[model samples]
Target: MTPYGSFSFFLILAVLLAPTVILGLQGKRFHTYNMVVSIVALGIIFASSLTQAIALIIFTIWQVVLIKAYITYRKKSNANTIFYLAVILSILPLILSKLLPFLSVVNVIGFLGISYLTFKGTQLIIETRDGLIKKNLPLSRLLYFILFFPTISSGPIDRYRRFNKDFELEISGEQYKLLLYDGINKIFRGFLYKYIIGYSINHYFIANLRFIAHSHFEHHLYYMYAYSLYLFFDFAGYSAFAIGVSYIMGIKSPENFNKPFLSRNIKDFWNRWHMSLSFWFRDYVYMRFVFWMTKKKWIKNRNLLSNLGYILLFLLMGVWHGLEIQYIIYGVYHALLMIAYNSFERFNKKRKWWPQNKLTHVVAIIITFHVICFGFYIFSGQLFHKGV
Candidate 1:
C-alpha cells in the first residue's frame, strides 16, 4: 500500500492520538505511553510495508543513538567525532539500499523516505554537537517526529532546532481542527497536481521514455521537456502533500516551493525550488565544506575558496542523487553554471556594461531556463546508456 493511502493515513492518526489522549487523561503529567505508541506504530509500519519498515527502523536507531552519544560525549569535548561516526553508520543502510538496488529483494530499491529522513537524522546529530539546543531524547518527541506519518514519506526538511521548538507547543482543539482541514485541502490539491497534471503529461505527452530513447531524432528533445515538466509536478506535488499533512498535526512545516519556474537566475531558482532541500545542503553540506577548507588552509582567499567549494559541493550533491554517472554529470553541470553566474555578478558590480532593465531580466530568465533543461538530459538516466 502507498504510504499516504487511506488505510495508512487513518492508522497513523489513531496512533498519534492514542498517546495524547492517554497523557491528557493521566493528570497531564509525563506518561510513558508515547514509547508504547511508538512500538505499536513500528509494528504496524513493518507489517504494512517494507519501505515503512525501513523508515521506522532508521528513525528508531537514530533516536536511540543520539541519546547514547550525548550521554557518552557530554563529558568529552571531542565527542562530535563519535557522533559523526554514528551518524554515518546509521545512514549506511540507507546509502547501501539506494546505491545497491540489485541487492534488494522484490524491487525495493530504497525505503519510502530514507533520503528525507537521513537529513533529519543528520541534522539532529549535528545540532546536538553544536550545542544549539539539547533535546531530552524523550519518547514523546521521538514518536511525534519519527512516526509523525505526515512527513514520513516526503518532507519539507525542517531544521532540528526549529522543529523542537514547534513540537513542544501544546495542541488545542481549535488548532487541531484548523490543521486537519488545511492539511486535507493541501492533500487534495497535491493529488490534483500529481494524478491529474503529472500523470497526464507522462501518459499523453511523454509516454514511456525508454521507447523515445530508442526512437529516431527530434522526439528526444520533446521527451526531455515533457519529462522535466512531469518531474516538477510529481515532486512538487509530493512536497505539498507532506507539508499539508504536517500542518494538520499542528506542525508548521517550512514551505518547499515558491514559484521556482518563475525564477530569473540559477541562484533564484535554488532559492525557490525544493527550498528545504537546498537550504539543507547549503547549511549542512556547503557551509561545512567551506569550514573544512578554511580550517585546512587549502585556499588562502576565503571568497574565491568558498566559490570553488560550492562547485565541488554540488558535484557531490549530484552523486548523492544517485550512484549513476549521469547524476554526477548533472550536478557538476549545474555547479559550473552557478559558479560562473556568481563570478560574473561580482565582476559586473565593478563595471557598468550591464543595464538593470526588464529586458535584461527577461533574457537572463530565458537563458537560465534553457540551461536547466539541458542538464535534464543527464538527470534522466537514459543519456548515459544507449539501451533502455
Candidate 2:
C-alpha cells in the first residue's frame, strides 16, 4: 500500500494514531508509542515487496553503524578526509539507486524514500563533522528520527536539532488540542488539493489533451499548464498530508510550499516551491560549494562563482530527480534563467529602469509563472516523447 494513497491507508492511519491522540490530549509524551507505530507502519509499507523490505533494513543498519562510528571518531578527531568519507558513504546508496537503473542493472540497493533517508543521514554526518551534534545520541532516538514514517517518502526535510527538540518537548493539553486542530485542517486541505483538484486536472484536462494530436502547438501549450498545475497540487497535497501527520504525532514538519506560482522571480519561485528540498540544496550543496571555492580562491569573481554555483546546484537537483536527458536539460534551463535574472537584476538596480510598482510586480509574476511552467514542461519529459 502506498503511503497516503488510499482509503485503507487512511483508515489504518486513523486506527494507529488513536493512541497517540489519547496520550497527547492527556499531556503525556508519546515518543515510545510513536516509534512503535512508525516501525509497524514501515513494516506494512514494505510488506508487499520482500526485496524492498530487506533493502530498507540493510540501509537502516548501514546508516546507524556509520553514524555511530562517525560520532565516535568525531569526538577524538576532526579530520577532513574522514568527514568527506562519511558524507560519501551516507549518500552512496542513493547514488547507486540512481545509477544502477541507467546501467541496465537491477537495483538491489534502492527502495522507496531512499533519497530522503539519505538526506537525513548525510545531514547528521555533516552536522557531526561541524561539531553541532556534540552529545552522543541514543540508538533508539537515531532509529526513530531516520525511520519516522510520516515524512519518509518525500520530506520537508527536518533538521536533526529541530526534530529532536520537538521529540523531547512536554506540551500542555491545550497545546495538544491546538496541534490536533491544525493537523485535521491541513489533512482536509490535502484531500481537497490531491483528491479533488489535482485528480480532476490529470483525468479531465491532461488525459483529454493527450488524445488531441500531440504535435499541435495548442495541445502542447494546454498540456504544459495542465501538467504544471497537476504537479503542484499533487505534490503539495502529499506534502500537506505528510506535514499534518507529523503535527498530529507532535512533530511540526516544515512547510514545503508557499504560493509558489505567485513568485516574482526564478529565485523567488524556488524559495516558495518545494521549499524544503530547494532549501536543502541551497544550504547543503550550493552554499558549501561557494564557501569551498572562496576559501580555496578557486574563483575570485563573485558573480562567476555564484553563476557556477547555480549551475552545479540545479544540475545536481536535476540528476537527483533522475538521470534522464530531459531532467538534465531542465536543470541547465533553470541555471540559465537564474544567471540571466541575476544579471538583469544587477543591471536594473544600477539603472532603475524597471519601475517598482503594482503593475511591475504583477507583470513579473506573470512572466515568472510562464518561465516556471516551461521548466515544468521540460521536467515532465513531454517534449522528449516520440509523438510530441
Candidate 3:
C-alpha cells in the first residue's frame, strides 16, 4: 500500500463532514471545518514525516498567497511581476527536490503530490495573471480545490478554471455513494495493475542484466519492451487511482492517458501518453516558444524552428523526469527520433511510392514502441534489478 492509504483517506472523509457534523451536535454555524480538517491533516502529515508536513504547510500558504494576489490584481486591473515571481518561488522547491536527488546522500525527497500541486497552482496563477480567469472562490472552496486529498498525490492535472467551475454544488447522497464505489474500484484496479501485472512482469518475465550482458540483441530488445509496458501500467494505474478518487469527491479530473500503444507515430504516442504533462508543456512552454519565435523573425521558416523548439522542449521534459545522465540521454534520444520521423514524413509527403497505409502504421508503431522501450532502459538506471 502507498504511504497515504486507508487511514489518511478515512481522515479526509471525516473532515469533509466536520461542518455539518459539528453544527448538528452543537447548533452553531461557525465555519471552523477548515481548521478541523487542517489539524487532522497536519497530524497525519506529521506522523508521516517532517518532509510532508513542510510540504503541506508550503502548499497551504501557496494557495492563500495566490488567491490574494490574483484577487488584488483583478481589482486593480494591472499586472504584478511580484505575483509571477511568487509563482516561480512556489515551484522552486519541487524543482530542487526532484532534481537534486541525483546528487544527494539521502534520496529522501518523497513529498506526495508536490509535483501535481505545483503544476495546478502555477497554472492557476498564470491564468489569473493573464486576466483569462478570475479569482472569486470562497476560502473553503479554494481550500478544497487546492488541498483536496484525492488528486493531491499523482494527478490527472486538472486546470484551475475547469475545477473551480464545479466548486459550488453540494455533495449529494447519490454522488457520494457513486464516488465511494468508484474510488474503491479504482483502488483495487490500481493494486492489480501495480502488483499483479507490474510485479509479475518485473520479477520473472524480464531477464536480468547478467543475462542481457551475454545475450543477443533480440533477447535484450524483448526485455526492453516488457519493461516499458511495466512502466506504463504502473504510471497509468496511479493516474487511474488519482482520477477515480477525484470523481468520488464530486470532481471530474482530466484523463491522464489514452490507449497510447495504439498510436501510429511518436508524436501521436506522446499525445496519448501522459496527456496532462504533454498539455501542460504545450500550454506553458511550446506555444510560448512558437509565439516568441514567430515575432522575433529569428528564423524565416517557422516549421524549421518549431521542430528545433520541440527538441529543446523535450530536453526540459527529460530533466523533469530526473537530473541523471540517463534521463538526459533518454530525452535526447526521443527528440532525435521524433525529429527524424517528422523529417521523414515531410520528405515522403511528395513521394507517391511511400507506404502510407495500415501496414506502414503497424510498422511505425512497432518501431516507435522499441524506441520508447530503449528510452525506458535509460530511465531505469539499473537494468532488470529486483523491484525495478
Model 3 C-alpha lDDT per residue in residues 1-388, reported as the tens digit of each score:
2423445554565556545344423433323453455455546646657766775677678657766676676667665566667677767767767756766645344476778777877777777667776656677666666776656667777886788664444555555566557766776777777667877777777745445445565556666778788898888777876776555445667888798887777888889998999889878778877877888888778668878878877897888777877778788877887788778778888775568798887887887777777878777764534443
Stretches of candidate 3 off by over 4 Å are 1-46, 74-87, 99-110, 169-185, 207-219, 352-355, 383-388
Tens digits of lDDT, candidate 2, 322-350: 99999999999999999999899899999
**Which is superior by TM-score, 1 or 2?**
2
Higher TM-score: candidate 1 or 3?
1
The TM-score of predicted model 3 comes to 0.80
- What is the alpha-carbon lDDT for the whole of candidate 1? 0.69
All candidates: CA RMSD (Å): 4.4, 1.1, 5.0
How many Å off is the CA of 278 in candidate 2?
0.6
lDDT of 1 by residue, 65-158 (tens): 7655664575466555686786686566567666675444443535666677677767766766777645356655755565555566667888
Backbone clashes under 3 angstroms, per model: 1, 0, 1
Q: Pairs clashing in candidate 1?
A: 179-248
Collision pairs in model 2: none
